[model samples]
Target: MQTEVIIVGGSFAGLSAALMLARARRDVLVIDAGKPRNRFASHSHGVLGMDGIAGSDLLKTARQQLLDYPSVRWLSGEAVEAAVGADGVQVSLADGTLATARKLLLATGISDQLPDIPGLAERWGSTVLHCPYCHGYEVGGGAIGVLGGVEGAAAKAALLADWGTITFFSQGLPITDDEAASLQQRGVQIETTPVVAVQGEQPQWLELVLADGRHSAQRALFAPALQAMATPLVEQLGCRLVDSPLGVLIDVDAQKQTSVPGVYAAGDASVIGNITLASAEGVRAGVGIHHALVAEDSRPRPTAG
Candidate 1:
């Protein structure tokens, strides 16, 4: 089916952009696979007005609101592949359905690759967490642990000191002199023993099992996971990708337009941010797409010779 705009991944960014296009009375189609990066979290934080709301509930309400527009459509399927043609862009779904649109917005979020520690995966969004700003306050100023593996683990530990007593577990990973100095200045303790596993229950309580058979109990563990794109559609569409400290992300401009013309990206796929920033980027992409379409329609045509 043909549409003015096709938004793939109907999470925060996709849905936000679709709302704009729909408001403009553009025929917009949002294809979603029903998986959001924050789906694991029981409640969302740091988002204004909707603070403490469950991620699923917020998305449910947003989806309902977007669908109220007459010009908007939603598809409950994954976009397996995408290609840009002379006229526009085409997206192929997993079920082999084809969708064509003059412009495409990619809000396909990212996936987190957790550390290979046992029991950690099960308590991920509940006790083992990322982004102190998102879940720190709930720690209740208790003992907090930071697992080392990803870049800037020490810095994260130091920053999280304001939330609770921090212990930086190097896990045999080397820490720089500067990092050590900073940790000391921030009153963050350093534990070089490798973490063999995590034993705990939900709602912010954990025990880190050290390789030497020692266990350290803490209110919560902050471990940075390696992030990867949730879908291969970016590569399939030939959009430019850039490397960030966390992972590779799609390259976008001030207006959220991707390297490929008529293609735009937002949310976790294009930038490392939270729900608020993702929604903001979505709004920018939506306005950018709308203006581009208007310009294209208004361009003067050559008279017959």
Candidate 2:
């Protein structure tokens, strides 16, 4: 099928973009793989008017809002490949379907790679988190532990001190004398033992069992160096990538347009992974696409002389 715009992901970013285009009377289609980065997170914070709302619920509301527009369509499958050619942007689905669109929006979010500690993955999003602003207030004023052995761990631990009493787990990561003194001055306890496992009941408490047969109880564990998994669909389309302190992200212009013309990206794929920011970028991309379409349609035609 063909559409004026095709959004690759249907979460916050893609849906927001689609809503804008659909409101402008454009035929938009959104294809989602059903794997939002925050799927494991029960509730999402920091989004105005939707604070503490369940992450899945937010997507459901967005989907329902899109259903109100007849010009918009959704596909419940993965977009395996995408290419731009004379016909336009062609996207192939895993279910043997092909979709073409004049403009394409890639909002496919990134995947976070956690540490190799036992029981950590299972408790991710609930007890173990990355963003202090998102989950900090909920677990605030308690004993929080920062897992070491990764870059920027010390700084993160120091920053988190305001939220609670911080315990920096070195986890076999070397700590210099000066660094130790600074952390000690800030009253952040430094544990040099390795963390063998992370076991806990989420929203209540967590225990980090150390290799020395000791365990530390904390309200939450923060990991700063979680790696982000690249999106194959975006790579297949040959989009330019930029390496930031967060991770490798899709390069975009002020209007969220990527390196390739007629192709745009937003959300966690282009910027830091946050629902509010992603939704805002999606709206910008939508407006940019609308203006581009209007300009193209209104271009002057050569007179027959």
Candidate 3:
């Protein structure tokens, strides 16, 4: 199928882009795999008008709104591969469907690679959380544990200081004397032992079982070692990527256009992972695409030789 724009990933970022382009009268097709990174979180916070809304329900509402714009089409499928040429960009799906478009937008958010601690995965998004701005307020006002030895771990613990009592589990991560002093001043307890397990459930609370046979009770645990899952599509399209403290992310300009001319990216794939941030980037990308298309069409034609 041919379209003016093809958006891969129909969650927040993708839907936001579609809303802008469709309202501008552009034919856009959104291909979604149906699994959003935030699907595990029952309700999303920090989103201005959408606070306390379930992640799934928010997407459902966005998709329903798109029904008012016939120019936008939604496809439930995974984008397996993508290629860009002088003519346009072409995307392939796992179902063998081929979609071609003048411009391509990738809102495919990165996947988080959680540490292999027993019981951690099961409690993710509930008792276990990430992003102080997103989950901090909800899990605040109690004893909280920040896991990981990375550079960002201490910073996370420091940020959560005001929310509640924080315990910084170094997890075999060597902490310098200064880092320890800083955390101590902030009322954060430093635990050098690694976490062997994360036990218990939410509402009832949880326990951070350590290797030293000491279990620490916490209202919630924060982990800071999120990594982006590798995707070959970006490489195939020749988009440049930059390694960040969080993980490798697609390098894009202020307008959210990637290194490739006709390719754009938004959401967790490009910047800090947040629902509100992702949606804003999507709007910028949509406007950028529209401006580029109009400029290309309005360019003066070359005179015949």
Candidate 4:
């Protein structure tokens, strides 16, 4: 199919970007595989004007609202490869179909490489969660646990303490003298034992076993998921990625245009903010793509030799 812009990953970012392009009367196609990282969360918070809404429902509403612009088309499919062309780019789909556009936006998003702890996946969106601001308040005033992941993760324990009594599980993560003193000053429980597994299936609170093989209980648990960039399409297009707090992210200029001429990235694929942040980024990216395309449109034609 022919379009002015092709946006991959149709959740918050892709959809929001598409909204702007569509409003500007551009023929935009959104190709999504329907796998959103936030699919597990029942309600999203901290997003201005969208607090207390389910993640899936918010996406559904965005897609429905996009229908007002007939220029936008939604497709439920995965994008596999992208190739640059004189006009713009050609994106290949998993089903062997081809789509062409003058510019490309990759909202392809990322995946959390969760540790191989049993029952974590099932409780991921529920009682066991990430992002203290997003999920902490709901699970507040209860016994909370933070599993040590990489270095500097002890900070997460202190952050969650605002909502409840906090515990730092340094399983195999030896606490230094200073860290122990800090926990004592803050009334935080310091457990240095390895977490054998979690107990309960629904809420699935961690049944943290201590070094002495004793079980320390927590009503709600927090563990940082190991995150990796979801797509190389940006790298394939030569976008330079620089240091980002969450990890490395594609470097985009003021227009959300990557180092590559006609490529853009938004949402979790580009920013590590919450859903509200993702949507806002997506809208900005969409507007940026519009200006980029307009500039290319208005460029002068070369004189015949």
Candidate 5:
């Protein structure tokens, strides 16, 4: 079947973009496999005007809002492959169906790679979190532990110091004497030994076990929690990637159009942006796609006999 645009991933980003296109009377189809990075997160914070809303509930509301427009179609499945073709772009779904559209927006989000620790996965969004702006307030004024997987964790620990008593466990980072002294001046305790595991009576209260067999009790834990975005669909269509501290990043202009023509990306697939920012990016992409389609239709064609 043919559509004006195909949006891959139906979370905050894809849905927001589709809403704009549908409102403009464009045929849009959104495909999602139901795997969102924030599914474990019960409530999402730090989203302007949307603080403390359940992540899944926000998705449902966005989907409902998008559905109010008849020009939009939501497909609850995966868009496995995407490629540019003579028909503009083609996407194949998991259910063995083919879809063609004049434009494509890739919004597949990323996955957080947690440390190799037992029980941490179960408590990821509950107690073990990455973003301070998102979950810091809940654990404020409590005993906190920051696990440094990537560099620059010390600075993050300092930013979080205002909210709690900060203890940074390097997991094994060799630091200069000056660095240790700086952390000391900043009132941040530094631990360089390896961490055996994190334990606690409940998911909210956690304790870190040292390799030397020592244990430290704590109420909250933070980690860099670096992620690898799922941007294969965009990469498949020849989108140029740029490097960032986050991970493999896509270089796009202000309008959310990728370096490649007729292709756009939003959400975590472009750069590591938050849910609200991703939604905004999607809206920009929708506008760009709409204008591109209008331009195509505006060009004068050969008159038929």
Candidate 6:
């Protein structure tokens, strides 16, 4: 299929970009794998006007609204490969379907790699979390725990203290003296014992089991999750990759255009994970793509010689 713009991954970022292009009467094809990074979260917070809404529900509504435009089309599948050529950009789906467009926007999002602790994965997005800003308020000023091993764990623990009493578990990782002092200054308690397992009821109470046969109860555990690109499409297209504090992300400009010409990236794939930031990046990419397309279409053609 051929379209003006092809958006891979139709989650918040892709959908937001599609809406903008659809309104501009541009033909847009969005390929989605139907698995969003936040699908595990029962509710999405910090988004204006839609605060505390279920992440899935917000996506469903947005998908419906975007599809209402005649120029917009949604494909439920995975884009396994992508390439850019003089003609345009082409994306191949896992089912062998090929989509070509004048420009490509990668909103493929990211995947969170949780620590190898028992019971952690199952309770993720509920009792275990990554972003304090997104899920902190609901902690209700209760006991909070931070599992170590990720970069800047002490700083994270200090910041999380605003929400409640914080317990920073070192998980056997070394903490710098400065970091330890800073954590102490912020009234954050440091626990050196490694967290062997997490136990809890779904979406409510949680208990951390230590390796030394100790258990600590808490309302929620904040563990920094290592992030990785959800798809290899970014590398396939030769887009420049950059390292962020969280993980590797596709390098993009202020307008969300990737290093590769005619290719752009937005959302968690390009920037830090946040619903509002993802949507905003999508809007910027949409406008950037539209302007690029217009400039290309308006170029003067050479006269026959």
Number of backbone collisions per candidate: 0, 0, 0, 0, 0, 0
Q: What does candidate 5's lDDT look like per residue over 198-269, in tens digits?
A: 777666578888889998887788876666766467657778888766567677898888887788888887
On the 0 to 100 scale, the lDDT of residue 49 in model 6 is 99
Kindly report which residue stretches of model 3 are placed more than 4 angstroms away from their true locations once superposed: 302-305
lDDT of 6: 0.92
Cα-based lDDT for every prediction: 0.92, 0.87, 0.88, 0.82, 0.82, 0.92
Per-candidate RMSD, Å: 1.2, 2.0, 1.6, 2.1, 1.8, 1.2
- TM-score per candidate: 0.97, 0.93, 0.95, 0.92, 0.93, 0.97
lDDT of 1 by residue, 218-273 (tens): 99999988889899998888888899988888999988999999999999999899
Q: Where in model 1 is the C-alpha error above 4 Å?
A: 302-305
If both were scored by TM-score, which would come out higher, candidate 5 or candidate 6? 6
lDDT of 4 by residue, 156-196 (tens): 78667788899888767767787777777777887766676
Displacement of residue 189 (Cα, Å) in model 3 is: 0.5
Q: Write the per-residue lDDT of candidate 2 for residues 1-305, one digit (tens) a residue.
A: 99999999998999999999999999999999899988988899999998999989999988998979999988999888899987679999999999999989998988787788898888888888898989999986779999988766887788888889999998787888777877888889988888899887876889999998998999999875444544587778888989867678889998888898889998888897589998998999899889988988899988998
lDDT of 4: 0.82
Worst 10 residues of 6 by lDDT: 146-155
> Which digits, one per residue and each the tens of the lDDT, describe model 3 over residues 178-247?
7878898999998888999998957579999999899999999998656684456887888999988988
How displaced is residue 95 in candidate 2, in Å? 0.7
Please state the error at residue 119 of candidate 6 in Å.
1.0
Backbone clashes counted, model 2? 0
Candidate 6 local lDDT, 118-234, one digit each (tens): 999999998899898899998898789998887888889988989999999988889999999999898999999899999988777999999999999999999878889899998
Backbone clash pairs for candidate 5 read none
